[model samples]
Target: MKFLKVGRVAIITRGRYAGKKCELGEGLKTNSETEVLTEELQVVIIQPQDNGNKSHPYPHALVAGIERYPSQITRRMSKAKQTKRSKVKPFIKVINYNHLMPTRYTLELEGLKSVITAETFKEVSQREEAKKTIKKTLEERYTSGKNRWFFTPLRF
Candidate 1:
């Protein structure tokens, strides 16, 4: 059974979020029917390539939805403006362990675990709120000048 700590950053290797980056947030039982429980875990996608869910083709949606850093945030910007300018679009998913390629980075944000979860994706309002949480945390992290590599877009 895999038992990885929450908050480890990883890249999705399959499915709609493939090639995108995310942070491990919760550990879930891979199965409960036959397994002893304690296998796979869930993640919070911080830098997604496209519509991580739904039937839409990943390539088509990825053209404009990819982002891994904080956009310019000026003091003059209003709350609504800031929210609109944010490029972060986080998704919470309880995916299989094999699909995630763990990285050396780990990012722990306040209220992240509470706001982001597999259920957060069930409703549009919840997803939007979670996105806002992710954006705020990321902006804070970026401005604080820590976890530089985690926030940088992958090259090549």
Candidate 2:
């Protein structure tokens, strides 16, 4: 199986980070059954930065200047019963690869000065703009008036 490389830009399609983009970090090896069972298959790390949105809760906020998420976690069988526990502190969020959307964008971590060049910035900006326009058009077309309802209203 092909593994995700570091520096890849992926969107969190599941947990708290859902709809947010992040850069991949280092890979981790599993040495025990618990690790395999928890489906802590891979680690994805992200560093918080200023998003310029005041309402954003995680604006440049992180527990240790970084966050790590495992590739997957099994569902709970019982709401009150805790199944797996971690000795290491839990991350700010967690998600699986099934919920991650790999993007065409890739982050360059070669050096601080060369991290984001003008060309790369322009490409990213254009992609984001296109996404916004598509989302706006779709919402306007499909979410207007009575289309929001999944079923017809019942007449008493």
Candidate 3:
């Protein structure tokens, strides 16, 4: 099974939100009489706005209603396949793990406020700082051509 945890920040490497960032929301578990110990490992995520909005455009009700597995959230598909489904699919799309790049940052879950202490916040801050330093170094060393960046270039 893939290693995943709630609150981890990830970048959508494919789909409409390819360049956008997201955070793990919650995980789904399953229980059965046949195997009392076996569990289904699935996850749901929250795609935060790039502009850092106080409230996400997608309502909390919608987010809570959808049950997206990790496989659905991180799967990569070709442009042709994506176009085929675009017309009929729902506005909110699930991404795949292969398409998500987990960043060094993680958002604090409101439900876990009591569990996440000051020390956890310090660790998150340190990770954010490290990410900034890494980004700065990468920016200094790498230059992208007009159409060479990972995300598809938008045409006017």
TM-score to native of every candidate shown: 0.59, 0.30, 0.30
**Predicted candidate 2 versus true structure: per-residue lDDT over 76-143, tens digit per residue:** 54433322211112222223345455556554433222222222224557434533442333234333
Tens digits of lDDT, candidate 3, 1-156: 133345555554444445444444332221111112221111124322222223322222101101111111113887656434322111122333455566565543244322222232245574345334423322232232211121122232
Q: How much does each candidate deviate from the true structure in C-alpha RMSD?
A: 10.9, 18.6, 17.2
lDDT of all predictions, in order shown? 0.51, 0.31, 0.31
Instruction: Candidate 3: give its CA RMSD in angstroms.
Output: 17.2
Off by over 4 Å in 3: 1-3, 28-93, 112-156
Colliding pairs, model 1 = none
Off by over 4 Å in 1: 1-3, 28-68, 71-87
The numbered model that scores best in lDDT is 1
- Shift in Å, residue 35, candidate 3: 38
Per-residue lDDT of model 1, residues 34-85, tens digit only: 2232222223333222223443223111111124454667889998887565
- CA lDDT for candidate 2: 0.31
Q: Candidate 2: where are CA atoms >4 Å away?
A: 1-3, 29-94, 110-156
